[model samples]
Target: MNRTYLTNIDTSISDVDFTQHKNAVFILHDQLNLDTWPSWIREEKPLLIFIESAAKGKTLPYHKKKLVYLLSSMRHFAIECAEAGFPVYYHSTKQHYDRALKDILSQYEDLHFTFMTPSEWDSRERLRTVISEFSTKVEEIPNNFFLADAEEYKERVKDGWLMEYFYREMRRKTGYLMDGEQPEGGEWNYDEQNREKLPKDHSVPSIAETETDEITREVIEMVEKWYSGHFGESEDFTYAVTRRQALYRLNEFIDERLDEFGPYEDAMAQGKYDLFHSQLSVYLNNGLILPKEACDKAEEAYKNGNARLNSVEGFIRQIIGWREYIRVYYEAMMPEVREANHFDFTNKIPEMYWSGETKMNCMSECLKPVIEQGYSHHIPRLMVLSNFSNLTETDPRELNRWFHLAYVDAYEWVVLPNVLGMSTFADGGVLASKPYVSSGNYINKMSDYCKHCDYKISKKTGEDACPFNYLYWNFIDKQRETFSKNGRANFMVNMFDKKSNEDKKAIFESSADFLEEISRYKKEQ
Candidate 1:
């Protein structure tokens, strides 16, 4: 006899079941955890579900390897779910979610279903509409992959969503950065300690390991075959394909590099991807590893004397501070959020973003890493590439698409908050108090990009001048009236006042020429 029951369920419960059908489907996103499937499996013994290339809304200009990486990762997760004794039903969807759901419902009439909430705002909205259309009830499961629930966290921090306050609350609640209710370190942040530039003679340690097993090898081969037309180099894809490999990478960072992570976290060096930087974001974002496990490992390293408090705090802040904050912020504002254009930017993105063939050394170096390896450190992302995009008046949506396509770890939920909000200030002031616009001087201060560039770093107007110098002031000058009223923009306005009208006009003309040249290349691409 078929039976169904609905019990008391809160949003925190990671699992739910509809007991009538013997067969059920668990729709899994690429970033969702497999453990959330057990409750549905135990009750209905239903088949599992997965969708390949689940990206909807727009077709992105992604590197071929990135496309393959996401699809292959989804396939691998499906295989593992099958091995765990769940009958799996997986399909690649080129249709929109509504069409895909209609197709699936048409095929399986007697199936009960449960789905972990999708990370992306659009996906969740689509699922809501689709499920409402079905006569049969569907259970929505909580996503336990995150350290805290999004809805709950939103309610908790509704009054003020500042990251510092939220981060402090998380540390207090979890005892992550605490010692008997006091912070382990006297200070909550170690920002002052984490700004050392790499010494010219400094040597970066060789990466811990690069060993891919049979599954990863097969995934890589499939990516190369299917996505050869995309922009990135296929030969440089060497990320951990499984949870085991991801753990190894994390442990290696905690053991060998975490102690120095804080002091050099923002430093960029030539031919170095891991100078006191954790390369585990690819794994964490892909669901191969959890943020809590990473945080715990870093904390353990501090206790074991393998790392320092500053490093542990800094690492934890990325997961708890930036990562969690971004996820919450994305959920709070989306759909409409994506359409925001505080700068009203209309300029096209440069072709060099796709080709990695820019004359600007910082842009070239940063884009080369992304094109070749599908990754770049955070500083290069915020300060170098995104900074330039903001200064050049590149459309935030276009820039957002480029970022989402370029990185292996890129997903709409994570990348949008970072790109549109923090990087570009496209959300006005919701994500960032001010745009992270900077000149070649800031780049020179942060990295050795100036030493290698063809232009004079200090010059603002001539042919041999740095592009960033002119672009930076031009951005400020163009947007001066908008920014003049913003409290956070007061410093930049004051800096603007220091320049004479002729000097500003000269910068504006130089910037116009530079942007025109970039626009020509964009059309060619």
Candidate 2:
């Protein structure tokens, strides 16, 4: 007789079972690779389960495209596992995770379960609850998906926790572009070379599009019916759903797009959605393309003389440096980090975020791509969307929620720090050295948005002026005490202090009128 002992760890409970099968493993959504499967479990060739549960779908109401992509990809992965001779169980049901685990456990008596640690806190805590309900022992294996481990980050981030130092350490550790303890070009960052605006009449590179198969089509329909009121479009889904397709897209990016990606990574244009970006964040976040794979591919392009050193270095830095750092930062600061609202902004989110019914061409332009495909590059997220939110004093938590719901690449681990820390400065100065607010001049200099907008970027006051101008000033004045102490932003505060009393008064009045109008925008939207 096989014996299974269930521990009453928390409120969650599991029924007793007696079965001969000894082990099984569960793969969470973010941990989709076979490499993450534990070695001890590999010896057993345990039953692999991927549950499609209601816990995710009903939690915060995700985008339709995001939902479809995950479900379709999981289904496709299950098929691949079966073909590879793994005993795979794909459960698609409308229930919580514990119920799905219960159903799986009921299939074989006395079967011990195992899972790779999740990439997120909420999911990890949820897993603990679910495992407590099972009579069999559940094993947790370490997640090795990231290039930098937690100890590496903790070791380096002791003094001030700056990203540049952490990033340089990763370069030294990975040896991606190391030249005898120095970076490839004797500089740690090629960001200066990567800021050139898109030249007029230059053609943007076209992105690789994946053909939707039967599985994707089925997912599309399922999202349409089940998630009717979700924030995204389900039709004409084009994301690569399998690891093979993701790898192919990664190669195509290296061969065709990597060279130009560096020079124009920060540029945003009138109708150009993706100028030279690989657009592989969704695949990277979903585990179809690992961070190591992306970094190696870009480095390969430079070694083979297909891409310039600046382009290759810039691209690789994003994956290994920024992407890896953000994940580590999210892990280090959580639970409390999620609710960090340093500015104490309480204003409701403007209706324009959802409807895109604004005269600001910059905001409208950014929203167009986001609404259509559930995607956009980093500049827009920082400059247009988050920049606007920061200047207006919109609730950081509110903006964070919108980001979590809107983007396909948004997992809590990625989205929370990028928003609370980097994007909105919601964590005060924890993630960013200074706030990232900018006037219309930065937008006009960076893109052609001002030339086509209704308001004049030159004007700093009144309704005909660019909203970013006064809004930018208003934020500086409003958060003067908070910002005046930081060296990176103190200069801007000095500039604001030097302005004449009349000019400052007019700027505040105009901002007040605009904000009042914004308060009424809910009815318009």
Candidate 3:
């Protein structure tokens, strides 16, 4: 007779049979790749569990497209796993994950549960509680979704933890663009060549649309019904929901957009939403495509002379360099990092972020794509959206929450560091060397937004002056000490000091009036 041990220590449960197979694997939404599973789990073909918890969706006012993408992709992956001869048990319920999991564990005798470690810190803590309660029944394996391992990051990053140093180390380790020991082309970065503005009237390649399947259509309807009050529209959802479609998108980007992606990487335009961006962050963050595969394809394109070295190197840096570095930063600085407020801003985010009703053309144009489709490239996100928030003195936590709720590709791990540390300077320059604050002249040089705006971009202070012009100077004047220590930003303080007292007074008055006006803009209830 096979002896059966109780999952929890209880003297009353002694008559259970151990011959029956009660092993199962729980798959999270982000861990959608079946190939990443351990070999024994794949061979045993144990029962697979997937949970679509309504409580998780209600945690935030998430973008409609984000919900639709996650749900449709998860349902499709479940269907694929079932077709691959796995015994699948999927729960679509209103209960939280813990409650639903407890029910499953109680229904079976000595049921053993195995799952990979969750990517999120909050989710991991919750799982820890369940593991403690279950004791002998639950086991967690290491997560394999990302390219770099935690041990690799720890081993490689020893000094000041600068991104360039870590990124160069990663290049050497992966040998992606290394020439023996040095970087290919004798340079570690091609970012200088990637800053050209888009020529006027330049035609961009049209975005390819994906044909929606029945499962996706069902998910769209469900998202519409459940998240009626969410921010974005689900009707224009064209994101790839499967690995095959994601791979197709990667190939399409390489063949069409990769050549021009580097030169105009920083350019912004009136109606062009994507420009030359790969638009694959939604898929990559959710594990539909691996980073190594994406980098490999781009490297192949460069080798074949289909794309330039600048474009290919820039693209590879995003994956193996910046993306990997951000994850490491997020892991090393969390739980306490969330509450970091170096500047101590307490104002709410501007109402125009949600309404798109600003007179500033750059803010309005950049926010249009975000409001309509839940998408925009990084330049618009950094220069326009985050820049305005920093100038207006919006609370970093509030801005971080907005980004998390607004973007289709955002998660806590990415958004927290990007917003509080880099975007808003909330962490006192932990991630950024200096605050990414700029005046209107930079925007005027980079895009055609100034040509269509109501305010004068040339004016530094007056009724017709661009708000960024006055607001930027005011920010510098107030935070002079912060910039005094920063070598890259100290010149701005000297420039502010050279301004006449009359000009300084005018800047303060203009910034104060604008801040007051925005503060009074209460959202329509």
Candidate 4:
């Protein structure tokens, strides 16, 4: 049966009377709400339009699965809307956004079209421009998924855009760690406690496996067919696609692993894909799960004696602290924000990012999981892969695009703020206070990768030295002038100034060689 042809027979209003009243079109992805629809429908009885934009298809990389995931999810959402007493017009176009809108408007001459604001900057801007031509009113509704409403967050953080301050405020307001208005753990953050590396013999519980449904299986087939020439492996494409499944996964993480999540949240393991980390990001990003619900569940677990306050607070901070903060920062500084580049670094992304053949054990292992499973925990993403990209002076846009393409949870609204802003510091200091660059020592301390790596983690020069060691110094030397003015980077500048010119040159030359070899290996694959 062709699911696309399924219709709501009871609400089958005819095309003949479509132009009779003022119609408003609400554009929605699967991640958006239907409750947002009826209010608009009551106001105008508008023909709800869901478009799979050709622009998105063109802009995304060939190998990126985001297009397929988004389209299929939207299609599923559209089918649900049709069944729920709503008149929906679904359009899949290859070209001309105007053509689609014009065609729809021709059918309903007096249609006063309006759509909720898109989370992505590009989509929002494009729709805003196109909708300006219509004589009717176009109102953009506020997105309510976040705990910190945009206007409220902006007003609350008037002193500065610092995340720490904002996070503390949220903690106080929500009573996340409060014991009757006082902090429960005495300290506001357990960041010191959370940085412990996993013991060598530490055992991680097996990740739960999910079987793909027929719809998901079809989506996987479509991705394989269209994206065969793209980078990354095509196997084992399992992700939660609905709210119920996402909730189940969340519960399992809280009940089974939340107790240990705090102490080893930043630790990485060679063969482990999830080590005390919640892999619910893809679901949260796509609207399958809400942040509030995830946070509330963590709090509930803590209260029920299933988890510790440290673990629950740590988990809540990711959503309420970093995630919400990044979104607010993105909205506040976008359009101009995407163009920020403090170091003015413009090196091309090396091919090793696609093929996991690098000598850097952290990068190799992290990329392997990313290519195979379309996922990696936060620490690997922030500290390993992203750190390498920044240290090697890869073009922030290229690195940002690669991250957006490769990750299962990559959406522009989420990925752009994280990759360009937080991870890479490509947006200067607007998102992150400082660049997250680190030497091989950081990797060695965090994981067991250093033990098996051929390169010496302690060495800064010569053939046996880790590439990250040379790259770290080279990155600092290259960006000294840019970082000197930054108060947070003063210590790094002093360290760079201590190195002799000859030693600096040697590190620079070695980094160049490492980057070249990595690039060649990627092209060969």
Q: Residue 375: error of model 3 in Å?
A: 1.4
**Which parts of model 2 are misplaced by more than 4 Å?**
1-21, 39-44, 155-159, 519-525
Best by TM-score, which number?
Answer: 3
Off by over 4 Å in 4: 1-25, 35-48, 62-64, 83-85, 96-99, 110-114, 135-137, 152-160, 499-506, 515-525
lDDT (Cα, tens digit) per residue for candidate 1, span 1-525: 010110111111223232334455556545545654455465544666665543441255566657656655555666665666656655555466556666667666766567767777666777777688775746677666677667867644334368888889888877897888788878888889888888897866665556654555665665565455556876655666666667888888888888889988999876676588887888788788888889999998899888888888999999988899888887677677788788888777778888888778888888888888788889999998899888878888878878888888888889998998888988877768778888888878878878888988988897999998888888887888767877878678789879999988889789888887774235322
Best by lDDT: 3
Query: What lDDT, from 0 to 1, does candidate 1 have?
Result: 0.74
> What is the C-alpha local distance difference test score of each model?
0.74, 0.81, 0.83, 0.72
Question: For every model shown, what is its TM-score relative to the native structure?
Answer: 0.89, 0.93, 0.94, 0.88
In the range 1-525, model 3's lDDT, one tens digit per residue, is 111211111221222232355898889888898788799878988888888887888888788888888888887777777777777766677767877787778777578989888878887887777788887889989988877776666433322367888888889889997789888899999999998888999989976888887777877777887789877788977889889899999999999999999998999988888999999888888889988889999999988999998999999998898888777777777789889888898888888888888888999999898888788998888888998898998888888988998898888878887888788888888788899889998888778889899999989998889999999999998989999989999999999999999999999999999998884224431
lDDT of 2 by residue, 141-255 (tens): 7777888887667544423488887888889999999999989989998888989999999977687788998767767776777788778688778888899999998998898
**Best first by lDDT, ranked:** 3, 2, 1, 4
Off by over 4 Å in 3: 1-21, 151-160, 519-525
Cα deviation at 49, candidate 2, in Å, is 0.5
Count of clashes, each model: 2, 4, 0, 0
Q: What does candidate 4 score on TM?
A: 0.88
**What is the model-wide C-alpha lDDT for candidate 2?**
0.81
